[model samples]
Target chain A: MVDDGGLDVVAPIGGAVRDLLRAAPGASVDLGAIDPRSTPGLPDEQLTGAERKGWARRQVELVGRDLARQQEMLFAGAKVDPDAGRRVLLVLQAMDCGGKDGTIKRVVGAMNPLGVHIRAFGPPTAEELRHHFLWRIRRALPPPGQLGVFNRSHYEDVLVPRVQERAPEHVWRPRYAEIDDFERELTAAGVVVVKVFLHISKVEQARRLLARLDDPTRHWKYHPSDVDARARWDDYQAAYADLLGRCGTDVAPWHVVPADRKWYRDWAVAHLLRETFDTLDLGYPPADFDIGRERERLLGTAGPLKVNRS
Target chain B: MVDDGGLDVVAPIGGAVRDLLRAAPGASVDLGAIDPRSTPGLPDEQLTGAERKGWARRQVELVGRDLARQQEMLFAGAKVDPDAGRRVLLVLQAMDCGGKDGTIKRVVGAMNPLGVHIRAFGPPTAEELRHHFLWRIRRALPPPGQLGVFNRSHYEDVLVPRVQERAPEHVWRPRYAEIDDFERELTAAGVVVVKVFLHISKVEQARRLLARLDDPTRHWKYHPSDVDARARWDDYQAAYADLLGRCGTDVAPWHVVPADRKWYRDWAVAHLLRETFDTLDLGYPPADFDIGRERERLLGTAGPLKVNRS
Candidate 1:
């Protein structure tokens, strides 16, 4: 019964609309179900299914290239100004077989290291576990003007322990509230987080595993025991579903990408990034004062870098 | 004079041979030119420039994926093995517009983040300047099984300020001894150090700069004042030439890559990384013990993890 207005292109789940609005203000968006009034600012073309995925891959490459280019420029100016530090925190997360690495390289491979700071989190050290679950992640945040991506994030506190039943029920369950609060603070501090769950079917993951084992170059990737984690698939999926249902928020939303399509995943990330950067009110630094005027002012003043003893 | 041998498609440099020898006790090595013999054990095709880069990038991707894989796997057999900690510290330094980032992305992009740590140094912060030049750098040394790339490194102490007269005469001059000693300590501490200087011509940089300006996305990479530094091209080149003359050592030699051809630069880094990893006797982990034997030991002991005792 909703108004079918512009060029419609989203599914009825409301994720794409939520993602766009969360990424950029005043971004009027519609997905496949509605016929929108205009498709001017739509991230992807109105194509659906396979065609849309093809377009998405090319679009992701463009967005990633654009992101790298912008980050490099802003960083070069860091010696002069620090304002370029406000880009969004793009966090990529998924289960054991999720394709975060290939996705990151394909999407942001060309970024200048000097511009974008990448931090990958591992399991808790003795000290890390002693503190709140979010402690380690908070410390690794990208300083201003950088796109910081957390490979596995604070969500682990809620996600894994719940599925594994490693922690007491009450302790792990309450963490969802804590996470929401922490994200709000990050947003308040100018960190916009885009959390993505790359949803790949178990069958696809099995195929990838087989490929890794068959290829010599990929032999390094086959950790003989990844099969054990695969056994817990149902438990993990239920946990992630609970996570997406509860933690999806207006400030920082979860994008449950149907990652069966790698091209579509790349396109979704690119679309998300463009929206994030387009919203930031960022530009070139202000000009330096006129050298002649500064010289005249220096002559008018008795004070100098070296103060007189008198 | 070094003996002349027919050049091979790929050959070992002196630094690599030394590290290989260091890894295996009593292993003999020759450093004069590419040693005459090729290892028949290594599959001939296993030694391509693309394969080398593919391996390292694959390792990094494996590490990143492992970290993001699942909580249990990250901790299952984790911790930087103390023995492997004596690995190399490979530093890549280049001219302002040279392709250091490209070198890393193409070479080690596949390696796991767990095995590599990267830091790019520009000007020192006020707090950093309070200590010795190497003070900040020492803290960034890579742990075991890791590769570290420094975009512009402490060599700048000699390369830049020395040319620009940014420091006093005695202060800048003696740092040559100071730097040599600092690296000697790293090598002595069991860290293999291979340093490179990607030498790009002024004309090449100008072309890249123009390219950056012409593309709207790339425009973010432009800053007007970088032009001021580019104007000092001749002096900086002289400074670099002098630096190479003084600092090139048997332990940590410099590879001056002619970067006009971008693919050639990529190939060089790929070759260098493969050479580095090939040196390590990265033997597989000790065999997993029989679960039945370990189970009895665990049952006989104080049992599963003790929470605590007052």
Candidate 2:
């Protein structure tokens, strides 16, 4: 199913994706918009969200496997690159318990450890809260040719603080501009920032929360605050609404996937990645110096060695 | 720190680690056991569990990074190991939402993906459950010099199936022996199996569950089924205790890591890894023929091609 003669690697990379990100800077895009272009389409009219998620999970696993192979090729004297000085930053933020860990598992599986890095940000460390919101994030940037993933990211400046009003409204508001500038810098300097907001419905979230409590294997995963937040769902929704309306720009827009169905989410993510890599136009760099050319270059300039027999 | 220097490299490759597994197959060794071997008079006034865990997390991060570098070096130019039949299988199981994902992140963060493989098992698909429990797991064993990490594994045959009563108690109970046999077979075949069970307290689980609900960005991560398991806390604990008590073995023993503290869990995993790799004694192979040796062998044996023009 070639969309346009071949794998239609659409979804603006250096173009619209980057441009919109730059324009809004801290804004998130409705990444679902990139659908049809990503997975082509599945003909299962009867598939449930969970089933879709399973399929997407498999797709992600395959993508992760692909990343692993690419990494091996690089180690084999290949000059594949992101040209991004040192990292690919993945930002995953969703309502509490949004499967960030599950997403991380499937997405990063089979990746080269040397070239992939993961940083998870929880309630900010006291030291973290004291600094500018982006401080912890800036420190986690992946080294060149590396992929750096953030379980939660600087977006929390907008997300958590806004939803909880933990920071004075005024303090948290300026962060949008600051985040825009920071991401812009990262993009211009070669870092491709991919942000995913897992959009699960409130009911699904409640269901997952209850699952945590019911599964003894999951008991350690429960928390009282989760019940508390369930009470404040409305506030979070309003905050998210404001976020979507505000942050999506040209340089580093967020990809808001409908996480209500994980399969769709996973497929969407892999598709996005395939498109991004295609856009980078990545290829093995020409050998340091062509061996043939190098031999010829020395052929005429070299003199014969002195012989001991003389 | 030395833990009795019984591991001698003179033995064929992988023999030392294998021997250790065979000896302690049933004893659940706390791989993260911090020895005071060198600190004879150190005070025992340790930080509470939380602080200790924090320190452990930092330590694991450092070690994971180092491990990552080593894997990269090996992949760069190392010869294919002659004892290339050995591989590693790391199995991590925990109460729901315990730091399984984080453990993978910190532990495998630096591993070279060229040879390592990761698989996460959830409730089996209809196809998987229809056959023997070991079907999916048996397929993922890593090749020699490679690593295979399992997030949740065959233990589920004993863990979840027991709690849910999906099969008769007799069925799951005996599967434990089967699992032991399965892992034992893996070890005999050169698989270094290391298993970890993160044990978190009920209170801690409550805190994490709450965190998911409180954070809007993390909301989709919760599920209703989680609560159902929590209500059956006693049943799960019994299942875990039975599995731990029965399955902890000399060849593939479990590490009962106290999970109240996340950092400690991380530290313990990193330490377990260091011990596993360091204990393996992956020494270099004998050198290939040098130029002199090559010349001797080549006195009559012509090399590739003589320069043109003779």
Candidate 3:
């Protein structure tokens, strides 16, 4: 099984997986150039179908445990010092049938839910529409020591409005810089903004949608609106490429994952988190009190003590 | 080792564990009479220490998978019918060193974080104090289809104030009836409230506290206030007994779990969740759209389509 090779005790922390996946800053993105079926970091050529999937699943689980431990430290550090302001926000954006839900269940689900907060942004309500585009997004930012996952996010403002002609160029164009500034602000305030775009081939999406339609249990996942969205696939791809190029920042570069393979998609996302957490160099918060004195006091007070009932 | 015996597909669901653990409504609770070290339904006597612990860990994992499946069905059901209002709220109450955190990490963490919302209620903030005691709680109640876990809940109002004499008898006394009414209202609103009290012996608590003091990594979990709370263990127990007797209702009963053994504590909580979910009898929401038509439409649209960019 593809484990972390005991990273907690001996192996060096994350680097290679991230290096393979991260989009280069200032580079123009061409979605057509990236292969949605490629396994960037794995030795895929040597493995059979089941073996590759099993390897990816094992890697996801291993990296998830490491993420869980790092998150505990993040949570513990905040408990010790509320002013630390350290937190992580993961922003996931994908086209329909691009494996966002699968990634969340297989990868993000591995963490202790106590420290994970998830918010799925759908179409705006009447109340939400009246506010600024980023209003709802800001409200959902993870608090100190939390790992927040946004299933579809403020990027929707740029994508849907532009593709559907709901907003003019002047309105949605500035949102790119606005989003960059907003993310930069979040980064400045100690939030590590991890952005990922799940890259799925249009053919794969059609296959997945057909499967959803074929299965009664999966019917809840499909809708007529999905077909409408599929019809605008090329426009959606163009919009995604624009956002990927414009939103890439020094602190929060966008990673494009080949999401046609469910296992690799889940593994890549989990590995991305592992690599990000590794950079934090988080340690368990130090014992704030006198350990020796507290231990002695604890040992001395072995007898039951009474409270005044009055 | 100890699985759910194929509860999903083959066997009957959810009665035995719940029946073994529920506190009888209106019955007087005797904290001292309950053995904190007892493994109520498990055959602990036949197994050695490691074997027993291993069995508990395996049971927790197995039941956790069942809980995960049930939660998915619940989420899917709600997605199909937003008005269904079906949701589960798990209220966890325990003394310091009584394994509330352990239960959350090992059991609740087993579910997908996407569907699990956890709120740890500590002392109320100034904003919270300005509102009704249930106001903050009402806001944190799980929305439709999600599993919400409250670690140390509104029962704190009754326990802390009464034991510490922060509120006069008349002021704090009526809260029992008030809490009962509040929970009843929640039950009427399609929420299944699973209340659990982790019962730990004072001697065991002292040992856990001493262990915290002995380990630097765990010191962040300890506070001097915990020692003070430990000093008043008897008063707290009395307060717990009172609330357990008064607040338990037909729809929402409280279960008392022996929590001296960490593995058993986690397993029991997971089992409790499994039993609760079983009663829900949740199924995937039916496909509102025409499956045959959608399948044909999906198959017809197999070719790459272009979007108008103008």
Best by TM-score: 3
Per-prediction DockQ scores?
0.06, 0.02, 0.43
Provide interface RMSD per model, one decimal: 15.2, 35.8, 6.0
Q: Tell me, by lDDT, which candidate is best.
A: 3
In candidate 3, what are the lDDT values of residues B1-310, reduced to their tens digit? 3343454421213346678888877745877888888778776555666677766676677778888889888988888887878899999999998888888888888787878888899898999988988899998998898999999899999998899998899988888888989999998999899999999888788888887887777888998878778778888998899888888788888899988888778877888788789888888878887888876777676776333111
lDDT of 2 by residue, B1-310 (tens): 2111232211112333223232133323333242211111111134343344334444565667656544433332133442646666788888776778677765775564444566678789899978899999987565465567887898877877778877788888788889889989988887788887777655455556556545543434445456567666667877776677678777777766655555556655665666676656654333232434433332323224322210
lDDT of 2 by residue, A1-310 (tens): 2132232232322333222222232333333343212223442444453454454455566666666545433322222343435345677778877777666655565564544556668788899878877788878776566566787777777777777777788887887777778878898887777776677665566556555544543443445556557666777766765665566556666666555555555655555554455445544444333344433333323234222110
Off by over 4 Å in 2: A1-58, A70-86, A289-310, B1-310
Report, for candidate 2, the interface RMSD. 35.8
- Can you rank all candidates by DockQ, best first? 3, 1, 2
> Candidate 1: which stretches are off by over 4 Å?
A1-59, A70-80, A202-232, A281-310, B1-83, B86-90, B98-116, B160-174, B188-192, B200-239, B259-310
- For model 1, residues B1-310, the per-residue Cα lDDT tens digits are 1122222333434444224222111111112122212221223354464444344333334333322222112212233245534665668776666878777665545444444567878788899989988888888786554566676788888766776678887888888778889888888876778776666655566666556554554444455545666666667776666666567667776655555556545545555555654454344334243434433432333124332211
Lowest-sum lDDT 10-residue window in model 1 chain A:
A29-38
Question: Residue A51 lDDT in model 3?
Answer: 77
Measured with C-alpha atoms, the lDDT of residue A287 in candidate 3 is 86
TM-score-best of 2 and 3:
3
